[model samples]
Target: MGTFSDPTFRDLMAQRPFLRLWAARLAGTSANQMLMVALGWQMYDLTGSAWDLGLIGLYQFVPALTLTLWAGHVVDRHHRGRIVAACLATQCIAAIVLMAASRGHWASRELLLGMSLVFGSVRAFQMTAQQALTPLLVPMNLLQRAMAFSAAGTQVAIIGGPALGGLVFVFGADKVYGLGAALLAVSCILILLLRYTYVALPREPASLATVLAGVRFIWQHKVVLGAVSLDLFAVLLGGAVALLPMFARDILHVGPEGLGLLRAAPAVGAVIVSVVLSRWPLRQHVGRTLLIAVALFGLCMVVFGLSTSFLMSLLALGVSGGADMVNVVIRQTLVQMETPDTMRGRVGAVNSVFIGASNQLGEFESGATAALLGPVGSVVAGGIGTILVAISWRHLFPALAKRDGLQAR
Candidate 1:
C-alpha cells in the first residue's frame, strides 16, 4: 500500500495547483453524491412512485445531453477555474433552496425536478471545464499519476457520500441538503483559490461547425475514437449496476444492507487500484493494457452473474472495479495527452457525452435485458458481449491496439 510519505505521493502533492483542484473535485463530487441520495429519497417519499423517481434522472439527463456541446465551447473560450467555481456556486444555491423547502414543508416533486434540471445544466459546463483544466495544472509526465490520484479521491467520495447521507438522514433530509450546501460552498472556494495561466483562445463565433467540432475531432482521431467508444460499448453491455437491487433482494437474499455493500464493492476495488497506479503508473504497452483490463472487467462481470455466493459476487465486483480503474486511468491520460490544449475542452466534452451515454444508457439496457432474459442471463449475455467488443476492437482500431504508451507520439 502506498503511503503519504511515498515519493510518488509527495511528488504529486508538490503540485500545489493540482492539489487544490483535486481537493475541490473531491468536495464537489461528495456533495453531488449526497444530493442525489437526498433527492431520490425525498422524491420517492413525496410521490411514492418509481416512475417519478425515474423522471428525476430523465430531467437531469435531458438538459445535460442538450447543452454539453455548447458547454464545451464555453469552457475552451473562458476561464475554466471560474467556470468550475460558478458551477459549484450554482449547486450550492440549489442545495440551499432544497434545504429551505424541506424545512418549510414546501418541498414538492416539481421543485425537486426543477433543481435536477439546474444540476444537470451546471454539470455539463463543470465537467467540461474541469477536464480541460487538469492538464494545465501539472507537468505532462505526471499527468497519469495525477489522474490516478484524482480517481482515488472521486472513488472515496462516491463510496462515502451516500453512506454519510444515509447516516445524516436520521436528522432529516433538510439536514442532508444543508450539509451538501456547506460542502459545495467549500468546493467553490477552493476552486476560486486555484491558480493557473489561462491562454485565451481566439473566440470563435458559435455555429453548427464550432459546436460540433468536438464530435468531428473524435470521429477524425481513430485512437481517441476507439478508446472512447470502447468504454461506451463495454459498459453499455457489461454493466450490472442497474440490476444490483434485484441481486440483493432475490439472488443474494441480503436485502438493503447487502445492497449497499454490493454497490460499494466496485468503488472499493477502484480506490485500491487507483492508489497503486498513482504510485507505480503504467510504463508501457498501455493500449494492450487497456484492452486487457476491459476484458478482465467483462470476465469479472460474468463471474458475478453466475455466482450464487454473496462473497463471490462481492469479489467479482471488486475485481471488476479494479479493472475499470485501470481502463479509466489509461483512457483519460491517453485522451488528454493526445489532444492539444486548444481542443482538449471540445474533445473532453465529446468524451463526457460518451461517458454519460454509457452510464445512463447502460442502466436502461440492463433493465430492459433483465426484463426479457432475467438478471443472470442479462448480465451473462452483456459480459459476453463486452468481451467480444474488446476482442473486435483489437482488429477494428489497429492504431489504438498497437499504441504502446500513454504519452502522445
Candidate 2:
C-alpha cells in the first residue's frame, strides 16, 4: 500500500513524480520569494516608510480572499495539473507586468495594486490545487514525509531566495522581477510534465452545490474547526517575521543584507528540521506533539522579541520555524487523512484562507501595533498570545494527542 520511510537518497530519487514536483515547487517558490522581497523593497524605496512596506503584504492578500472559495471548487472538480499550470502561467504574465512597473514608470498606486490583485488571484488558485493534490501523489503512510519535503523546498526559497534577491535588488528590482518571471515560466513547464489528472478521484463531478457541501462538512467537523482556529489565532498573533526589516535596520543595524538574513533564518531552521523529517517522518502521539511544538514556537517568538543581538534574534526565529514545521506536517496530515477524497480541494481552499489571514493579516497587525507599542512590545505580546492558544487548544482536543498517521488501502 505504501513505501518505507527509511530509504536512501537514491531511493527517494526513484520516485519520478516526487522528483518532478519537488523541482517545480522549488523553482516556483524561489520566484515567489524573490518577487516578495523585490516588491517590498521597491515599495519601501518609493514611499520610504515601514508602514508602506506593510501595505505591500496587505494589498496582495486582500484581493486573494475573494477568490479562494471558487478556486477550491474548481480544483476539486477540474483537472488539477491543468489548473496549476494555468495559475503558474497567469503568474508569469503578472510578473512581466510587475517588471514593467519596476521601471519606475507607473504614475499611480492603483496600477501597482491592480497587478498585485491579479497576482494574488492566481496564487489563490495555485495554492488550492497544490495543497489538495499533494496527498494524491504519494502514499498515505508517506504523506507527512512528502509534506516535509515540500516544506523543505519552501525553506530553500524562503531562506536562499532572499539572499539571491538582495543581490539582484542591489543592482535593480526590475532585474529581479525578470528573473522571477523566468523561474515561474520554467515551473509552469515542469507542472505540465506531471499527469496529475490520473491521481484524482473520479466523482459525480463538481458544482457549486458540491462546494457548499464541503463548507458545511467543515463546519460540522469540530476537530477541524478547532485546529483551524488554533492555527489562525497562534499564527495571526505571533508572526513578527514580517517586521524583520525594521528590526534589522533600525534596531540591529544590518542593512538590507542583514535584513535578508534575518528574513531567511526561520527558513534555514525549517530546512534543517524538514530534512530530518523526510528521513524520519512523523511517529505516534502526533496531536500532542504538535501542541508541544506550537508552544515551543510561541516561546521562540517571545525570545526573539526580547533579543537585541542580531545573531540571537536569528537563532530564536530559526527555532520558531523549526517547531512550526512539526505543526505543519501534523496539521496537513490531519487534513488529508480525515477529509473525504472528493472534497480535498475545497478543504484546502478553506485552509488557505486561514493561512492568508494569519500571514498577511499578521503583517498588517505587526505594522499597526508597531506604530503603537513599538516593534519589540508587539512581537512579545504576540508570542504570549500564541502560547495561550496552544494551551487552550491542548485542553480542547485531548484525543488528538493519541492519534497516529494514516494507512492507505
The most accurate candidate by lDDT is: 1
- For every candidate in turn, the CA RMSD to the true structure comes to 1.3, 3.7
Off by over 4 Å in 1: 1-8
* lDDT (tens digit, per residue) of candidate 1 on 1-409: 4356677668788999999999999999999999999999999999999999998899989889888988988888889999999999999999999999999999999999999999999999999999989999999988999999999999999999988998898899999999999999999999999988988888888788988898898898999999999999988999999999999999999988899899999999999999999988998898899999999999999999999999999999999999999999999999999899988888898999999989999999999999999999999999999999999999999999988878876
Screening candidate 2 with a backbone cut-off below 3 angstroms (N, C-alpha, C), the clashing residue pairs are none
lDDT of 2 by residue, 1-409 (tens): 2334446534565667777878888999899888888877777767777887766666778777878877888887778888888988888888888888777667235655566677787888898888877876766666777888888888888767877887898878789989999999999999899864354455565567766665776677766666667788878988987788889888888888788677777878889888888878767667778888888988998998899898899899889989988888777777787787678888888888888878877888988888899999899988988898888887776656545543321
| TM value for model 1 | 0.98
| Residue 115 displacement in candidate 1 (angstroms) | 0.6
